[model samples]
Target chain A: MSGSVLYDAPGPRARARNLVLSVVGGLLIVGLVALVAYRLYDKGQFDGAMWDIFNYAGIRENILDGLAATLKVFAMAAALSLVMAVVLCMGRLSDHKPVRWLATGFIELFRSVPLLITIFALWVGIVDAILPVEVNIEPMWALVFGLAIYNSCVQAEVLRAGINAVPTGQREAAYAIGMRKTQVTASILMPQAVRSMMPTIISQLVVTLKDTSLGYIILYPELLQTARLIASNTQVNGDYPYVPTVIVIGTLYIVLCLALSGLANWIERRGRRAKTGIAPTEAKVPEQTGALP
Target chain B: MNVLLDNLDLFREGFVGTVSLTAGSAALAVVLGLIIAGFRVSPVPPLRLFGTVWVTLLRNTPLTLLFLVAFFVVPQVLFPGIDSYLLAVVALGMYTSSYIAEALRSGINTVPLGQAEAARSIGMTFTQTLRIVVLPQATRTALPPLSSFLIALTKNSAIAGAFNNVDLFNIQKVLSNEGYNILVIFIWITIGYLIVTFSISALFRTLERRLEVAR
Candidate 1:
């Protein structure tokens, strides 16, 4: 029904042609899936014993531990990244040209580099080489710092956009009230900016959560790494449990990301409800017009 | 500096590998994304469901997990003779295509209902209208986000380095193992990535400016 505006109702011949195309497409997809499954079965990936490895208590414990470790790193990285985001956002919005340029350069440089390389470099170059042995740098710390560095830059951009979204009249009114620049930004601008951008901020945190899996490259005992260790070390009929391990690990990631997005959606809905609950008609108009530019 | 000079060949090979991997995966992703986007907007119910399900599954899972499946499970079970590089390309392509499809679908939504209605009134078939009038405008608006996705893909192609692929990151890893200065090596690799990503950003910026619709 929604597409009715795009085209006229299909005639008998056109409808028949559409039906044929759909059937063919459906068959092709089914055939492809069947072929892949058959190949997997032939390779013993579907053997009951391949999946039985997860039945062991030790394996379950290992997975839980890995999950916990991943969450731990993510928690630290998320908090630190936000703190750094605030600092970088402020610096980028600084009054001094030199300070702003430096902050901009740092953000752009880190943003452009791949997260994997950043983590690897932090692990091998700075933590291993420069940190004093007495300081005891861990892979966990390296990963945390690396993730924070990249994510903070991204968060700064999001925050900056939110700040820019605030209307010019608000800033002018704050200035007319004899407020200092810092006072205006801190009190008048930032709170409103963060409230408006809360959804974007939360989604970026979801990105950070997924990015924690990248720690596996540096031998961090994260979920994916644990899956790799278990799959390669345990054997069933002379074959590793690669299929089952990947399936489990991938499911865990999917669940975590989906939950995070669900939370984001809930927050966004609550924000919308709060606004419209007060002045339904007034709140709706600005939102519609805000999206125009 | 001397470390870089001495290992120029290794670096060059690694650079070429990175470029090829990014290019291969990006090309595959664009095609798959277009198909998925088509499925999403198609009049058929099942096709729309399939598109929705595919995007949700792929978009939620981490790229590293997909790579693990590709490198460890897929090759052994399905295509035993497939090289690690190709497997990496497939993994990156599949993962990135989900994002690309979402971007394209959003772009299509921006194509005004009036335009489509006009095309239909002029007796254009769905396919003809999409191909001739809709997609061109959709792609023009989608250019910025599509370029961002490609840039992200280039960065992610480094994950392939974790496998046996001799990409830039892998070469840097080998250099560090051979007792090269870690800081210097990291600097060079960072610069390599920066150059590629920035060039992509600049190219897209230019495209966006040139393709701006005249009001």
Candidate 2:
């Protein structure tokens, strides 16, 4: 009888208003969908040839290669970023002030800059300026480095938040037992922080996965870049198939990200039912520090 | 330094462009996010469904992909004559709305049951209870996270720079291509972004502190 937070059950007039409002809202959404369908039809975007371009083996192989490359970069970046985060968070939580400041500054600066710029700069800087005439750096490495740097900063902060979430008494008790600072931090704090913060770290990994699409800007031949190429280079029914290519490629990205998100959710739910004596408080889901794609 | 001084006009244009891009999209995202957050928590099944779909679709896609779609596909097929800048604004804003909605939903979840129950006991309508008792507290709880999203939006605007938007990153491309040092180009552009993002965080922090004091 009383569980709804905002309002009670609707009365007669309220029900009528709600029905009319929903109908209008539903109609508005349906109208939008119809308009999009009509536009696509008129433009011949729904034509068979445009959709059938995927029948080409070469194109499918390109998409698969792109997907593989994307995952490779994600895997490398994910591993490297975790290592970087541990180092940075250790510096951040150190008893020493300068190391803490240095780490904090690094995180803030990189965190504020766009990942696209970082990738582009790395591409140009390494390829054009840094490397010798005979030496070369791959575009894949540029993209990987950028994603790792930016996401590491974010992950480090997430780690810090998790450590902070540990009850202060947990730390004080360790100190009371004459445990050294490093011993308490390593043996006691780090494990609990990582456990409580697993969901957030995985969520940031999703951000890292999506960010690989920025590889397109640097001509890294990732999934989105492959889509751009296929859309621009292919010809079908006198049109470029930009719409179809985007739809297909966008679906791939959505599916991949959703799968990762599903993993995060599973781990989070499992964590909740985890039966530790008195489980450490779960860290808040880290606020997103990067842009939505 | 000379390169920066010589390209001050370009730098200024990019700075202003980023500021406007951020301001426009922030306005749109905040408004749309609030509406979607309403849909998410409303006592109607359809609205809740709609909100979930919107968040999932937007959140799962890449911003660069959205830029490609918004800049290339939509203008070509859906709205033949739409301005590129306008397209960028719409895309960026729409992408951001998902995060904002998520932030606000979490905020709403944090509101005490007693607060809402007390409002209902006073015979407040849903809209009134929400607008008065719920949203203010929600916004308070949501402000810290919301600020991070806005700063991320600023950096994300850099992506728009490559998409025909004359933002800070655009200046980076221009100056770097002009045979200037890449390091110098990055330094200046980075400073410009730091200014905008730092100002945003500061503004949000002050606003949050003000709200705290009032409470």
Model 1's CAPRI class? medium
Error of 2 at B26 (Å): 0.4
Write the residue-wise lDDT of candidate 2 on A139-196 in tens digits: 9999999999999999999889889888889999999999998899998899998988
**What number of clashing residue pairs does each candidate have, in the order they appear?**
0, 2
Q: After superposition, how far is residue B199 of candidate 1 from its true place, in Å?
A: 2.5
TM-score against truth, every candidate: 0.92, 0.93
lDDT of 1 by residue, A64-152 (tens): 99999999999999999999999999999998999999998888778877888889887775555655553455789989999999889
Please give the range of 10 consecutive residues that has the lowest summed lDDT in model 2 chain A. A277-286
Identify the leading candidate in terms of TM-score. Answer: 2
Per-residue lDDT tens digits for candidate 2, residues B1-215, read: 89889988999999999999999999999999999999988866667779999999999999999999997889888888998889989999999999999899889888889999999999998889889999999999999899989988998988998887899988888888788877678778888988888888888879988899453
Clash pairs detected, candidate 2: A293-B62, A293-B63
